[model samples]
Every structure is written in C-alpha cells, then in structure tokens.
Target: MASTLRFSVTFLTLLFSLWVVEVHTSRKLISIKEEEDQTISHLLKDGEFDDPSLYMFFRINDLKYDLKSGSKLPIFFNKDDPQKLPPLITRQEADLIPFTTSKLDFLLSHFSISKDSPQGKAMKETLERCNYKPMEGQLKFCGTSLESMLDLVKETIGSNADLKVMTTKVTVPTQNTVSYALHNYTFVEAPKELFGVKMLGCHRMPYPYAVYYCHGHKSGSRVFEVNLVSDNGRQRVVGPAVCHMDTSMWNTDHVAFKVLKIEPGTAPVCHFFPLDNIVWLTK
Candidate 1:
C-alpha cells in the first residue's frame, strides 16, 4: 500500500512539473510576441519615407488591409472605381488558355493589345517571371485565379488552417495621391506580432485579367498588420507590412536602401505592400 501511494505521488509530481514547464513556455512566447509588436509599431510610427513615390504608396487603394471575417477577400479592384475587375478563372481554365509564348499573338489579339505596347511588355514579363525559377529560400507560384491563389495559400499553410487575408483599404479619396507631409496619422489598431505565422504574399501582376504572383520566405522575415490615419485625418489606411530581417541577398542599390539610407544587410528593411497586393496569414 505504501509503495503504491509513493508511486502515485511521483506520477503527480511529474505531471505538475510538465504543466509548469508548459506554462513557462507559453509565457515566453507571449513575451516574444509582445516585443515584436512593439518593434513593428515603432517602425511604422518613426520610419521616414520622404520620397513622394514612397510616401504616396500608402494612398494606393488596393494594398489596404482587410481583417474582417469573411468567406474570402475578392480579387477585384475597389468598388468605387468604374472599371470592372477582370473575370477570375480557375487554374484548369488558365492552363487551357495558357498565356505562353506560343499564344502571345493570340493573347494580344484577344485582349486588344499591341505587341509593342507597355501592357504587352508587362504581360510578357509576367509570363517570364511566372516561369522563372524561384530564388533560394523562397517559394513562388503565379495564381491565375482566386481559386489558384487560395490553393497556393493552403499549400503553404495547410488546408485546415484558420486563414486571414489582408489588402490595403483606402479611406480617403482625394488624399490617395497626396504626400505624407500633408498628413497626420495614427495607428487605429496597434501592430500585432505574427510570430510563427505562416504567410503567403500575393502581388498583383499586370494582365488582361487578374494574375497574382504569390511567394513565401523561409526565414529572416516578419509580418505585421498596421492601421494608419494619414492626410490630416483625411486618408486612412489599413495595411500589412513585411520587414525583411536579412537583406544580405538584396542588391546593394535596392531602392529601400536609397530611401532608408541603409546598405543591404546593415539593418532590417520594412515596407508596406503595394496597393493591390495581398498578404495571407494563418491564425
């Protein structure tokens, strides 16, 4: 009887120790997340983007963040705009209509585009980029449709994941093109750390229809959600920003370096995703 009682006590002690260790780990993760949040908040508030091109980026309507629970974020342009969004097709459809060199002439004719035109060049470039091999530590895929984009996201973060999609939302119309100097902005929602969050960033590619180039990094990067009120209370933006922790692989003459006045790898480079870009995160 005494031996059994002792064994029970020992088992209870081991379980208690495990529980304590789990609690400690949880607290540590929370602390790290808090620290990351503070860091991102500081960068958003203090980082300078004096160049008009850089400053006006926040005004772009397509890059706004949408955190609201929904079935999924649509790939269309802002409803306020008159031009209707291009029809979104599926991967199978895209493959059949394949935008390839062999069909370049056919594509241009169908889209009413000239081979020598800028849009034509962009289309060709997009095709090339989509086919190009991804760099080390990067996973890339060009999504020709909403379903295709979601497929990539699911592949990256798992199909059962609780997913969140963010795009830039424009709050002020006139202020969209205005400079940052003319604005006084505040963070509507404090920056949140996305540690251990799986992410897929989708960049809108120029096409007759919607084409998204989605990519994810392996490491040395962080993502955050930011809300900004700019243009002296006129322009407000809810957006997602990514901070690249390692810029060592980046070109020395990268624009971020010129704007931030820091060389590659010297410091972390963070920038707001362009209007029309999407950042998918798993909750």
Candidate 2:
C-alpha cells in the first residue's frame, strides 16, 4: 500500500512538471510574437514618411488625399524593380478564387495559410476591405493582376492619354524610420489639365499573389514629384505625393485633421506615397 501511494505521488509530480513546462513555453512564444509585432509596427509607422505631423508646415501646397491612416496594410517597398512588377495573371486565374470571408476556408487552403495564423487574419481583413463599398466620389477596385489594374487605369483616364508612373524610392537599407523633408514639389500631372491628372493610387495588399487595392480620387486632387532628404542627410527619396482638394467626403476623425489642426472639409490633405504604392498620372 505504501508503494502504491509513492507511485501516485510520482505520477502527480510528473504531470505538474509537464504542465509547468508547457505554460513557460507558451509564455515565451507569446513574448516572441509581441516583440515581432512591435518591430513591424516601427517599420509601418504612420504616413510612410518620417515625422508626418510636420508635413503641415513643410511644403504645403495644392498637393492631394492623405494616405497616413492607421492601416497595417504593408510598409515594405517593391524589391527595387518597380518596372518588372508582378506580371499579369489570367482572368480565369484571378476570378477562379474569390477574396471573400464566406470562402475563408477555401481561400486559406489555397494560400496555404492556416486559418488561425497571423497571415490568415491579414488576408481576412484584406478580403473584408475589398468587399466594402467605396466612399463618396471615390472609385475603388481590387486588381488581382497588374494587367487588370492597368486596364482600369486606362479606362478611367482614357485609352489615348499618355501616362507616367511614379513610385517612392527608398535609399535607406535599415528597418528604422528616418525623418525626411520635402525639399520641393513638381507636378507630374497638374489638376488643371484637361483630364485633370486622373490619378490612380494603387496600394499593394498582403497576399500569396500580387493584389492591389487601386482607387482613383475625384477632381481637386494633384500629383507631385516630391524631393525628400533625410534629416541626417544620409538618405534621399524622390517620392510621389497626392493631395485631395475635396475633403467633404472624408471622415471627420481622419488623422490628417489632427495633424494639420483643422477639421475635415476645411482644407486640403496631402501625404507622401509609401515605397510600394504606385501613383499613375495621365498626360
């Protein structure tokens, strides 16, 4: 009977040890995940530019819409080869799989992402945003392929119109956020043109394949080639800035209002485009 009692105690002790190890392991994993998230947050800091709040006093002009919202979309730039962008996939290839929550299981399986994984959650959010309706005077479309995006741009601006594509050029290699000043602004396509610079802002979405959330803002928007220099004078990036003249349709609580110290619909809101974003200007 004493031997039996000893065996029971031994079993209980073994189970307790296992439970303690499991808890410790779980906590360690959580800590590692939190640290990773914080790192990404630093990389994706607001406005995609350094010290965006200072934009109000720096180089304020007829530039258009603010892209400095708190969206975790993506912060990384294209692999320095903006010209050789993701190729055009077939229409059937893009249409075969839908980006919808109802097909979450299928979509996750197609992308080889576990439903409970962080990537799966990101894909879900992208799907939801794509499905949402466009804002007032806003033209929104999700292009699964580069061809589709270009086609939409030509349709909106005009098939016969000449075009110029501009992307944010990042010179720094480190992951740290660096401050930059707008040295000067040059209009690639002015708002006063006949087509009024039919601008299309295409932002890259997180996906197995290249997906872009392309939207064209209404008139009263201007596209500019902004010359930026880092505060340390170590990095220089010639990026595109879009300014929205019509803020009446913008949300009252947009970050631009707070940064500029003005209410929405009162003044123009303009922000520098991120590294991966594409700004299409029609000539």
Candidate 3:
C-alpha cells in the first residue's frame, strides 16, 4: 500500500508540471500576436494619402511657428492677368507665410523610390521611349528646352548609392490647430504637344501639395477647394487645393475666387489643412 501511495503522489506532481507548461506556452503565443499587430500599425503610421497615384509627400502648414529666414519659398504664379506671371516671394516674407513642402522632389515618384539610389535609370530609359510627338495646333516648346529637361534628369537623378545618409521622419499634424494663409492659385491648359504627359502648369498649382492645422487625425481629409470665374462667367474650381500669391486679386474684380468646402469621398490634393478650428482663412 505504501508503494501505491508513492505512485499516486508522483502522478499528481507530473500532472501539475504539465499544466504549468501549457499555461506559459499559451501566454507566450498571445504576446507574440499582440507584438505583430503593433508593428503593422507602426509601419502604416501618420497620414495615408487618399489617392496613391498622386505621390507621397511631407508638409509643414502650421501658422504659429515662425518660418526660418533662409527657407526658400514655394514657387507660385498669378492667373488673373493676361501675362500669367508667377508671384514673387522673398526669403524673408516666405518665412512669415507658414508653409513648406517635399512634394516637388517626388512629383513622379513612389514611396519605395529613394533619392539616393540608381533606380532613376529605369525612369530615364522609359522617358527615352516615351511617345513625345507634338500635336497639331498645340503650343510646342523648342526642342532645346525638351532636350535640356531630359538631360538634366539623366545627369542628376538616382546617381547615388546609399540613401540612409539623411533621415526621413513622418510629420504628424497637430490636432485641432487652425491655419490661415492667402489662397494663391494658378490656371493652365494642356497643350496638344504635351497632352498625355503629366506636367505642373507654370501658372497653375506650382505646389500642388498643401497642409492645414485642423483635421490632422484623419488620414486623407482636405480643408477647402479653390474657385475662380472664367471669362465666360463660368466658375472654375480646383478640388482640395488653392494657390495663394497675387496681391493684385484683392484690388480688382477681374480675378474672382471663392473657397468651397470639400465634400466626403472627394480627393483633396492638399497635404495639410485644418479640421475643426474656430478660425478664419482671411489673408
């Protein structure tokens, strides 16, 4: 009977040890699953652009912080006059404007395409084979201008090896903050010569990307749309964006523009805009 008692005790001890091991393994599996979910959230951090085709960019549109004196102003043009001129921005005044961009640098780029790599070689090759026949009755740029633009790209883009030389961190817009600025705009039409190719209009939106202080929590919400009256009295509106520059617009009724609220499901092209700021965009 003593031997029987010893066997019973040993069996019970074994059972307890197995139970402890099972519980530890279950907890470990749960912890690993939780860690994987966190990593995914980290990779998709910050804002998500609504249209993936427009290109990824970083923007600084906060109005409170003073811009650095040496920061270069974004290129923009006035559209009200017949001459179609770009508005001038001095470095000092540009500092007060409260806007910055990384959009132009990636006009036709992908998130995976880094500036410090030779991947641009493929783009150059594609350009070489690009069908660039000028159309009838279209404004044609001089061959010299076309050649130079392509040559410049071949010489400068994607020639480097390592991209980690500079660190790129995501800029998170602050919640509930307001922004104000002069909504400058440019107008343009595609010529028959460059009908298919994507180009930033000289008088249109020189900087198509923008940001505001509100609506920072949502992934891809835009603050406002810009509008202008055509010569025929028709109103023209650019969705999710407007350019600000020409001081002449305020002086004359020739340039008609209005700020329209963007609706849900529309692609707002701006990178920054406000959410629920009890504020005004007068400037």
Candidate 4:
C-alpha cells in the first residue's frame, strides 16, 4: 500500500511540472505580442509622411530649450500685400504682456497704424533709419527671420551659461540619387547620452550582408524588416526561419551580437556559411 502511494505522488509531481512550463510559455507569448503592439503604435503616432513603402522615418527635430526662446511675438501680415504686415497677439502673449507690458505694448500700439497713414509712414521711416526693413506683403512676427532662426537660436543659447547647443548636418539620399537635408535644429539637451539630440527627416534602410544590433528587452522587428528589404534580392531571407537564424547563428559570429531573452515569440535567426559555401551559393 505504501509503495502504491509513493508512485501516485511521483506521477502527480511530474504532471504539475509540465503544467507550470506550459503556463510560463503562454505568458511569454502574450508579453511578446504586447511589445509588438506598442512598437506599431509608436510608429503610427510619430510617422508623418505618407509613403507606404517606407518602413519608418526619423522623428521631427524641434528647437531645444537652451536656445533663447524666440520672441514668441504675436504678429500677422496681409495675405494679399505680402509686404505690409502686423502682429496678432495670442492668449499666451496677452498673459505675458503684463510682465513685459511696457515694451510689448509700445511695439503693438505703434504697429496698429496702417502703412498708408502719416504716423505709419513716419514709423516706417524711423525703422528704416534704424535698419529695420518694412516687411512688405505681411505683418508677420518680425523677430528673427525663419531662414536665420536656427543659427540665431544656437548662438543665443550658446551665450548663456546653463545651455550648450550644437548642430550636426546629415545628408540623406533621395530616390532620384540627390542628397538632401535629413536633420537641422537647435537642441537644448542631448536626446540620448551617447547620441546628441537630432532633428531627422530621413528613412532607415537595410544594408546587404550587414547585421543590425538589437537590444534584448524590445527587439527591433521593424528595423529588421527595413534592413532585409533594402536589397531587392534579399527579401526572401526575412521570414520566420531566417529571423530565427539571425537571432541565433549570425548574431553569435558578430561582435555586435548580444544574448536576448526570448519569450514565446520567434527568434531572430541567421546562418553563416564558409567562404567556399558562400561562393557556391552565389554561383
């Protein structure tokens, strides 16, 4: 009787162990699915261009905090005239008027006169004497011109003690083979510790025979797709089997490879062949 009891207990323990493993596996699969969903959400929210073929574009760069806050001057210009312009105040500007009321109100009240009025003509003459160009066509905010905004902001911020702003220029290749600006903006603080803040407007492309490094926590499946499809002939090696090999074999050979804790999702996989075998495949 005692022997029979022992056998039953052993069988129950084995069954319990199997159940635990199965549950753990299922939970891992759920977690992976959640992560994939979050990635897709981010891409949808931040991507502005409508190129369906593009996998992803860099996020828009904006002025950083270090830069002198551009005179958030509220200004307007005549749509038809193109030159004669005036400033329109926003709610934020109105609230701020109390703090800098004397200077702001003086500028605004003087700007109220029409260009054809005597006082307006006198004011225009005075501005011209002071090197202020009567902005024709529109009464727009006449702080610094947009063309020089980036540079002016950089210089202004760099002058201050607390802030340091630098600019990096990256050239991106267009489909027509011409290179165009990818990012240009003043940054307050570095976005990433290693990589300074950037304003990007280019798409990421995959290169042939190159392995992309990915972190263990959130795998870059979309990035992998971009890399795989970059070469027209290399598209076939990107599905389930290849993804597995990329995560396992190819990663091991490259110095960039880092071990990832994969749950129930597919592993990025790669296969490497000897030089002779590679020649055979190419032939």
Best by TM-score: 1
Candidate 2 residue lDDT tens string, 113-156 = 99888888888888887888989778788878666776777787
lDDT of 1 at 195: 85
What would the per-residue lDDT of candidate 4 be over residues 1-283, giving only the tens digit for each residue? 6755664465355334322311110101100122332322322221232322122122212111223432110001001111222232344443433322234335436446555666555544433322433222211111122223222333422322222211111222333221111111222222222122111111111111111111111122211111111111211111110022223323233322322223222344221111011000000
Candidate 1 TM-score, true structure as reference: 0.63
Where does candidate 2 stray beyond 4 Å? 1-92, 171-195, 253-262
lDDT of 1 by residue, 1-283 (tens): 6755664465455334322311110101000122332322222122343333343222212224342311111111122121343555667778777667677889989889999999899888888888877777877888887666777777876665356666665455752452223233455555676788777888777788888898877777788776666424565667777777777877797776765557777777766765556787774
Query: By TM-score, highest first, what's the ranking?
Result: 1, 2, 4, 3
Name the best candidate (by lDDT): 1
Candidate 4 has a TM-score of 0.17
Model 4, residue 204: distance off in Å is 24
What is the TM-score of each predicted model, taking all chains together? 0.63, 0.59, 0.16, 0.17
Instruction: Name the better of 3 and 4 by TM-score.
Output: 4
What lDDT, from 0 to 1, does candidate 3 have? Answer: 0.23
Which 10-residue window in model 4 sums to the lowest lDDT? 274-283
After superposition on all CA atoms, what RMSD does each candidate show versus the true structure? 16.8, 20.7, 29.0, 30.6
Off by over 4 Å in 3: 1-51, 54-118, 122-131, 140-225, 228-283
lDDT of the candidates, in the order given: 0.58, 0.56, 0.23, 0.23
Residue range 186-279, candidate 3, lDDT tens digits: 2223111111121111111222111111111111122333222122222232222322222221323211211112222222223221111111
